[model samples]
Target: MNVLRVAVSAALLLSNAFAAAVPSIKYCQNPRAVNTDYVGRDKNVLVQYTACDGVATTQIARAIEARQSNNVCGAPYNTSCFTPSGGGPDPNDCHVITDALLYDSQNIGALFTLDPAQNTSLITMTYQSCESFMVNQDNVALTYCRTDWASILDNLAFNCQATQNAHGGLSVATDQEWFIQVQHS
Candidate 1:
């Protein structure tokens, strides 16, 4: 059984990414078309028509591997995408879980708005968070995602009480602010 499993795993990885791997936690390549699209190699660009939470739109572009690539033209590839508690491999900003694609681009523009507070504020290289230790005594951590050229801030906020309890009863306050200077190439 172990031998069979190993062989299967190796074969899949071998057949996986012949082209440049997309900055995706998980992805499938389309072999027939330009070899890759939002859907898959040569697959139809599926879209789902749904109303936005508070925004309304009149049109959206046809779903396709954005031709004429430039800066920020490809899908948002954030390896540091979030995982909801207890959920496996949460789809971050640029990743799409199977069956999550829509039927068309008629309403996708509505999904493009950026909240100044949550989306625009810049982060430093040494960002800090205490929310995890504060709530469940879990240590806070930060990492960079080369996939999307983005910084991932996880478990923000601090709780001194939870930190002390989680770390052998030593009172430790998570610094409210920190820096994470990212050098883009």
Candidate 2:
């Protein structure tokens, strides 16, 4: 009986140690536009935001929260969705747009900033419906500054527009596009 008790206690201690060593997994709904029929023929209009390397989903949520708190129509303009708390365009987070082609592909917006001192970078990409503006009707523009690429902004703009156009017209049959921008300092 004493040996049985000792074995059980050892098992419990080992289980507790293992549990303490495991990191928790958490998921947050991304604020980007998503397609309802992403898995089928009639795609809906909801997009999910994903985290980049060295960045956490919680950080992205915080950034969304920050942007939403400051502006009524912040990025990923999902009025019906909830914004993340304690994160928004801060120095520690990087943002990207997940669904830019659902509406007017030309109006997607994103911002990127890097702070070498803190070893952190922040990116905020907005996937909103583009208004009917005459100028630059087909082009989605973004400003980017990077150490390796002098024309990073131009590259980002080109990439964003191309991705948007690749969706082939905003319809139920099209797949979603993700426009990403990166900054290193």
Evaluated at residue 122, the lDDT of candidate 2 is: 18
Candidate 2 to truth, TM: 0.17
lDDT of 2 by residue, 4-101 (tens): 23222322322221121111112211211121112111232222212213333246555454233121112221001012222112112111122223
- What would the per-residue lDDT of candidate 1 be over residues 1-185, giving only the tens digit for each residue? 32223222322322222322111111112212122223322233221111112121223431121121112212222111111222111122112211122211223321221111111111111111110101101111212122212212121111112232221111111332112111110
What TM-score should be assigned to candidate 1? Answer: 0.16
Clashes of each: 16, 16
What are the runs in model 2 whose C-alpha is more than 4 Å off?
Answer: 1-113, 116-119, 125-150, 159-185
Model 2 whole-model lDDT (C-alpha atoms): 0.21
Task: Give candidate 1's error at residue 163 in angstroms.
Answer: 32
Error at 181, model 2, angstroms: 1.8
RMSD of each: 19.9, 21.4
Best by lDDT: 2
